[model samples]
Target: MRTSYFICGIYVLMDLASSDERSFRIYFDEFSIKYKVPDIFEKMDSTLVQLNNRSYINAEMILKRDVADLNVRAIMEFWKPKAQTNMKLYDVRVDGCNLLQSINKNKLFNFYVKSFKKHANVILKCPLKANFSYKMVDWFLDENDLPLFVPLGTFRTITEYFTQKRLAIRVLVHGKVLPKS
Candidate 1:
């Protein structure tokens, strides 16, 4: 058996060799999006759905204006059981176009690209045109992604999308890990 972990839109497999075989599995229960520039997006929709006994995140977004420069910043937070405060685990920003062009350079981003390659239809480079619709259907992370060790608990990842130097959209994904029996 294998377990997969997703953090900040990146999927990683928990394959640490240990004497104990028990491990936890992560699953998403909710997803939401916030538009800083409400009018800049022609359409934005994200929802968690169940299909054929499997969970998938369906999302679609259409831009109302063209974009020449693109950047992304992701912040991940982890919380203990019944904990009132959460701790920030990672926070980094990168050029979206460059990252997409050289997806293999960054191990984490490469996992994201691998997942997106199967489930998402969006721009891979710059010069995004207006009224172009992009979507991710039946998206779920599995063992074929990256490798990361995430303990049993809850986590939240907030990803912000930017056009030029201005903030455009924000994505909030919440999930938790439960012991597999």
Candidate 2:
């Protein structure tokens, strides 16, 4: 018996008989955050004037056996008072095949920051709510025919810092995934 192969544009061709499953470790290599104030009065407040915030986060996803888990670490720094808070996210599990299927079919995916630990000087009375959604704006195939996803999305976080003072931060996140070695 003989078999013929065809390469059409950027699509990758797969064989049904191949027992080898492609294992990919996707890295959330680059991410950025920008803070916004919805109210003009709040932006002009004197106490809030010193609120200069910056954040750096690194995250990665890997397949351990049949389960996929995500690990994320974030450091948020506040100026004026010179304080920083560290947060670590663990045990975030998702079906690896389902995630890839969603990306391939809809070009969109959603994930939750289900658990995290935070240490700060001032604590909030209510827990923060965070939602993350990613939409694939573009993608390309590598030399090995592995697809690299380039997604642009938004992250919204709501927290009550003080009595009757609620802060909502919407960050514009742009990220790319690279296959881990």
**Which number leads on TM-score?**
1
- TM-scores of all candidate predictions against the true structure: 0.76, 0.23
Candidate 1 per-residue lDDT over residues 2-63, each given as its tens digit? 33333522332323333335455557777888888876789988889855544588888888
- Model 2 C-alpha lDDT versus the unseen true structure: 0.26
Candidate 2 lDDT score at position 135: 18
Candidate 2 per-residue lDDT over residues 26-86, each given as its tens digit: 2232333332334311221101111112123422211112212221222222222122442
Worst 10-residue lDDT window for candidate 2 reads: 43-52
For model 2, the superposed segments whose C-alpha errors exceed 4 Å read 1-22, 38-111, 115-167
Error of 1 at 102 (Å): 1.4
Error of 1 at 65 (Å): 2.4
Poorest 10 consecutive residues of model 1 by lDDT?
8-17
Clashing pairs in 2: none
